[model samples]
Target: MSTPTKVPLGSLPLPLSSHTLTKNLTPDRTAASPKAFRQVQHSQPSTQRRARLLSPETHFSYVAPNPLPFPFKIVPEEGEDVSPANQAELIERWLAAREALQEKDITERSNGLRLHFPAGREQPRELIGLSETGLRDCLPHLDVGDAFDLLGLPRLTKDPTNEEPQETENPARRELIDILSGYATLINVEEDVDKSWAPWSLRYSGHQFGTWAGQLGDGRAISILATPHPSNAELTYELQLKGAGRTPFSRGADGLAVVRSSIREFLCAEAMHALGIPTTRSLSLISLPELPVLRERIERACVLTRVAPSFIRIGSFESLNPPESMFFLGGGQQEKDLEALRILGKWVGRRVLKLEGIKWREEGQAGDAWGRQLVLESARRNAKMVAGWQAYGFMHGVINTDNVSIMGLTIDYGPYAFMDVFNPYHICNHSDGEGRYSYQAQPSVVMYALRSLLTSLSPLIGAENALGNKAVSPGWAKDMSDEQFAEWRKQGNDLVLAELEDTFQDTCAEEYRRLMHKRLGLRRIDLDDESKLIRPLTSLLAEHRLDFHSTFRRLAYFKPSLVDSPASTGNLESSKADFDAFVESLMALTPEPQMVDTFKAKIDWKKWLEKYSERIESEKGLWDADEDVDLQRERAMRDANPRFVLRQWVLEEVIKKVEQDTKSGRRVLGKVLQMACSPFEPWGAEDNLSPTDILDDEVLEERRYCGIGEQQMLGFQCSCSS
Candidate 1:
């Protein structure tokens, strides 16, 4: 292991002398009560401590030759212009908000932790925490200072927090959207900008499998900013900076994410979101040009600001264990745990699962009927989430407890991939050499993670009530208690049944077998009749190892009569005409002559064609004409089976672009920010299909290779590398 660097917590560089601090302003002396005065006195020391911490030299190194760029700019909030008057008012409001939050003790915590508000400043810059090596490494290729020049944004010197600030006709509300839309880049300044701002975060820890992994806080990331949805203001989005520097929980490692990994995360999040999978959103990717750090061979690093409804991870809860445990804010020990779980569960159930009116109550408590409902809803939502992943052929390489979200949103994108080919088992992570996270193993892994999370809530579930903690025990009606237990059992059973159903549905079965035979130019087997379907399918499965997708598509188009009939001399001329036409068309694409011969040996082509025609005529309804039946066949032929996949390869290509730019020291700031702000719309450029569009044979070949690998591989690493 490499030696870790010493990272310092910085101070805020606000112009306090020139401006009165809003948070510390004295209220009207006569209006203040005695109790209020006492409270102020009690909190005075901490405020002084914060002020001391905010002083520049104590927190930062003034490296002048590499002076930081001014991070904030004035951009349009809407299409409306930003006038001087409006700007002044906006700044005042922002200042007041910041002060209010601070007065309520919402500022940065101890150590290097800080909050960052992208829209709070005039020109929003990426928050550079003490452990921000990732941004520093990518600064060479990225012009952090001039990132907004092409997007029609201008530099502004006036303070955004001024009480009576200038306003513009069109002022940008936040830089996150522009950066994501390929419009701006976030720069970092060491001397100026408030270092007092701490990212919004929750403390948590968890059990890794059955073993306790204590106090696993956010070792690298922080939620620094938020943006409310324009139309529905009630829904707010949290913008978190990953690898933005160190925090109290840094664990002696650089708090930065490598470019290679950052790109993977950015692309994967976007891909999953597009595929309709629940996942965290990537808002902006910023590269630090100056700070260099070594990771897997000194590669450049980058910071990705991600957006999500909540940043609550399983790890967050886990961190608040015995040592960090505190009061439940209003009540008893178990009460706190129960409340936390209930709140988190309800949010997950409603937002991620689209389930409304989910309720919860503490175990052994009177109102636990609601709690039971929350659990069931969570299970159903999780079941659907797993099914969606399977449908898209995606494999989440890592299934760590900490990585699993209560909301079922995929997070911490690492070695992951969509199956290139049809394989029952495929693994994506090379590190997971044990195949713990395989393509076929995801469902089980997810279940295991869920089970572990539930176990964490055991304390709240009153597991120790049998031992008699009078304060925690509810000596209520047995009927109510039994009902809660029964509900859990029912939900558990339903979850199992759902998983089984998904597995059964995903198996291609008869359709898959038929397609394989068709692709290999084998005799077409009739599936309409059970006997006919069984015999030929078995024979083909035994004879050749055919791929599921290719086989299914071919069977969808196969003309069975072409292989089951042969020519007789009595009608050789007409039979020969039809046979020649079929052979010519078939041979045009068939690579091996033996394949055609093999097909021919299995059936009499001419005879079968005659029989097929006769059967079609006989099957026609007594009053209906045979022409109608013929028309149906024609229509089926015209509607070709979909031979192409739109999800996997396309996503891979997009991920590749994101990865390349990140590696080359060009920030994906615009790409990610746009995605975070408007997840449904395409970001940047008119042509939105660059990743999916095929430019040449090589591109097709690459996709073919990826598809095939996906099918045959097992385990996270194996699948992802392939």
Candidate 2:
């Protein structure tokens, strides 16, 4: 091992404002929070012998880059001048240049062991296997600096506006690419050259619609290592490869992901993170020109490495409670699996979630109190997550128990959608014919997954162990007397089933209402207005099938600046007149030229406006005498609405534009990431893109360049291929 070196824990040389650089250094800290980034609730525990970000460097290994699979190098008719170039020769030269890099990260191409699940602990072997080989010519599409902020590393000094990477202007940007692309590029961080970390795979099981499918784990993803978050030593984050290669869990499929799916996840993950939703953050996207994968047709494969505090999932625990088909793993030997489940429960609930002492459990006969707490907290967060989805009109097509993250972030974004016309019944995934995971049914699906998880914990907690309406294994308390087993089940049911039911329902209701209030620009008030204001407005929109996103975006621009401010606080007449003009403008608003089925003359637009305006007027009575109710309402709306969303058509346009031209595609993807990453960048007290559909407006003219809104993407179809 190289002699241990002491790097300052307090600070490092980073190309970021002190405010942005150390924003996350302090554990559970809200110091200098960036407006663009949300303060993630989960953080590493401070393991500070001192404050230093250590790099766990491994030995250098070189393998020739793979050539792009044949069909992707689309050729013109025979004798055409166009010919595919050699990828291997180019990759060799690239590797030669980066050979000097010997940083601990070994060139951040994401090779890390999971947070070291103890050996002999019986982790699902299928989930922890060798990473598929043949990592070839990595073409960097985009790297997000905000994601690196979690590490508190030297930032790339991000500017979403630039469609092209300005690697020349900022050396840190180049450094970020090097580290994330698995090149030996070190900016200003500490390293450990002696110790090399191994990669880990995880196993999980999920219900297709409500039935358990056994041994479904991280089929194509492998976690190489987990270390303390750079800024906050308290929390640890695992960087893992998605679409990297195959694992033992690959079943019959090739463990690969195409560039299109990779880009979707890359942008959407960042978009969700920026929107303040708890999600796994993406670091970098690398595409291999020649790798091929079968989707609807042949496509090039790519890899995306994402960061998360912990990748533990409901399925992680559920796998220990395997499906009936795999009952041999548990069956009469169930206690062994139970013990393993408890160990994992404690690790995730205590080490990761920090739920300890009484917060984790009650003093009783329970063997794993953390199991119950994990389920409860998962339910609470998932409840809010669903609420966020509904408020933002996001339809998560698949909420399979396996896809449902224990961390409560949206995982596995296959065939998801953002509803345009407020159809609570909309199904985003074309494969989900029964609407089992539709917009309105998300809560039930989320609840079903939680219940499955809760039931899986029965073995750990000594309760009735039944899932999928059929027992996966024999009951955990089978040895107990009938009375004891019955009592244990009753108490456990009341604690988990009854208690979680109430909490989930109550929390989801209040939180959904809270989100809707913000979307509609309503000021704080104790009065329940589901029937009064919200429902009526929703009814109006639904009746006419008005565009959900555009309607809300336009609502944000409706506030007359002069009248809503504190200056006009007591002047009721002037406020009313200005508000009337705003209402009139909204009533006379025109739909985008492409709207064949949107809000129309048939709906009582003026009547709905009169009701909405009167409701705003009613808020005056609730505010303190000096408070500007209208202004508060507008501010809330501004924060809630986003001008740009990752509409399906937009993504398709990006794929088409970039495939024909890499340089041009990279530029377009950069612009898309910028808008998706900074959804709030366009609107303010200054430029107003409202009074018309943002698609037709010039607020961010480039957003219109994608040619998406000209074709409504509300019901665009995406299948399970992703």
Candidate 3:
């Protein structure tokens, strides 16, 4: 057992500016008063418009150092040239590196846990040059707000020419845009610049669809830069390029992405952030017309610049112990593998989770305690994240262990969709034929991924058992007898698993309840309302195939006064007619609604509406005393239920326009992005004149972006290949 290092307790201070912090960390989000709700409703959009300018001295200078800022080594020495000298030797080294990584010492090349190398065997530099497209300028305003402000990056004017003519006239914005868009390198010696940023690919393995898929690493993704956060030096933000080129891990397929998937990922990342969900933000999306890629067909290639605190995944920890399947290709040294696991877990504890002030004991109990807490933290974050996804009707479509971010940020966007219809059992990814990652199953699957993460960290977490005693050799799982180790492992695993499940369930339930109640305009949780109103509401929506987003927003317009008056038969009849009219507005009618559909839907909907209205009337006083509670509730509902979501059909339209005509597509993309950034805001005359199909006609503008698509497009699904 290795001795634990005792470090003093420390705290990560919040950013000086509140706008720089994530939505979760902001204290104002928890305020329950109507005044606070109004403040929050306006604060987010205002924050999106504001930018914190960077000082000129540090703005353009590269902040990242040579070999990257992370605490790891890509090569044995600082300037070792491991690159093969000849084409024949390149293949030999590639084959040998794979074999060595699996069977021999995995960290022989790099001292750290991660096996870092270039993008491909022949392509020494992992940073691929990308061509600038019309969409380059459009990304600076993709609703990310001031996220990139702290990176010492330029804050582009809303309109380069109209808003800030000098910004467009100057060359600084253009030069920086080229860097982020991948048209230039980070450290340009030609210009005498020396930021020393190096790009590298990482190696990790995972369990794919419940089966151990050995050595599934970053095949198409490359980490281009990692720099200390301007607000807190302790934190670092990594910039990664998706679809840069093939890495050694690209098994047998071309490592490229088409504009179809790139645009979806690019828009979805920013949209998710705007919705106040924790996600990896997109900095830029650049199209390479000369770089055509083959998917279902040959499509123009593109690269998406992704930003996040950490890119570590559940598969990262799982890769520590090579599975039996790897033996077929080669084998792994168990001792070295376990050592790498310990190193990686410790690094994550201190760096990623930011655990500080732990009293390290000689027996290594501190590592166990930290590891256990890491699992709990991950569980809580994921629970809340999945809850947000459920509240917004989002389906990740791909929830493989490899895709699960350890920090719980929504990463690896692929074939993801926000449901048009409210169906609990909706499956957004057609490739998921078994429905393993269905909307209803997302919470459980996230739990499954967490369990996999826990299993990988069990050896470190099991150093000390629940009884606070060293049950086996502190950091080694195989030191004791097979029977004894199994017993010890079972006891430790059970203890941690129990705590994780409690955290996951409690956090998920609380967050989901809070979000749902807010969207429904309730002041607080009410079991009666849940059973009689909320539960029935879902059943009715699903029965009618009603659009999830529009239903919640339209329900805000329901006038409780119409049905809250005295229960006279004559009055009830007149109120019932008005109620029926309101109910018709909520229905997702396309082409022409069937009389039978409306008649049958109204029966269940009216029953639900009566219960809902009664609950709302009862809660009026609880909502607000100083203001009009009805108006307050309506405002709160509108704030919670966005008027726009980056739906699949909308993404298809945007992508098509960009592919057909880049010049006109820029305007369409920019307008849609603006709407995504301020989703709760109503479409107005300002938006009615945009040169896009979405705003071609003022009368149909809201329907184009806010309304549900045709019945056939309601439950649209896509394959994982997308």
Q: Candidate 3: where are CA atoms >4 Å away? A: 1-171, 181-183, 187-197, 322-336, 360-368, 466-488, 566-574, 588-592, 684-703
What stretches of model 2 exceed 4 Å from their correct place?
1-196, 323-336, 356-368, 463-491, 559-603, 621-632, 683-700, 703-708
Candidate with the larger TM-score of 2 and 3: 3
Per-residue C-alpha lDDT of model 3 across residues 1-722, encoded as one tens digit per residue: 33322211011122222112111111112222223422322233121111121121110111111111111112333444555554333333333332211212132211112212222222211112121221122122122222222122111112333332112222334333333434343321111112112244454667666666666566567665554443345655666777755544455545566678877887787778777777887766666666657678778767777777778788777766443333322122222255456555555666677665554334544322577777888898899899899888889988988888888889899979997767899999988889889999999999999988887777556655543642223345435465654564566577699899999999998898888899999886876666777778888777776778878888888777666555643587787678768877666432335523777887787777777878787786686589887788888988898888888788888788778865445455656766676788865432344546453343355446665665667678987877
Best by TM-score: 3
User: Which candidate number has the best lDDT?
Assistant: 3
For each candidate in turn, the TM-score is 0.50, 0.67, 0.73
Task: Give the CA lDDT, 0 to 100, for residue 332 in model 3.
Answer: 21
> For residues 1-722, could you state the per-residue lDDT of candidate 2 as single tens digits?
23222222111222122111021121112211211111110121111001121111101111111112222233343454442474433333332332222233332322221111111111111010011110100112222333222222111123345344222333444333333332221222223212222233465666777765655666666554344533445555556667654444555556667777877777787778766667776756666555557878988767676767667678777766543443232112122254445546655666656664533333343332455666788888888888888778788888888888887888877788777666778888888889898888998889988887877775444442332222122233336565764454455555678777777888888888888887877766446578777777766666655667767766876543424544656777777677666654444333342442334532465555656666677667665678676666666676788867778877777777656655456555666776676676553223544545444233344546322264356578788876
* Candidate 1 structure quality by residue, lDDT tens digits, 111-182: 223322222312223321111122222111112232243222111112233232222322222223333221
lDDT (CA) for every model shown? Answer: 0.40, 0.53, 0.59
TM-score of 1: 0.50
lDDT of 2: 0.53
If candidate 3 were superposed on the true structure by all CA atoms, what would the RMSD be? 14.4
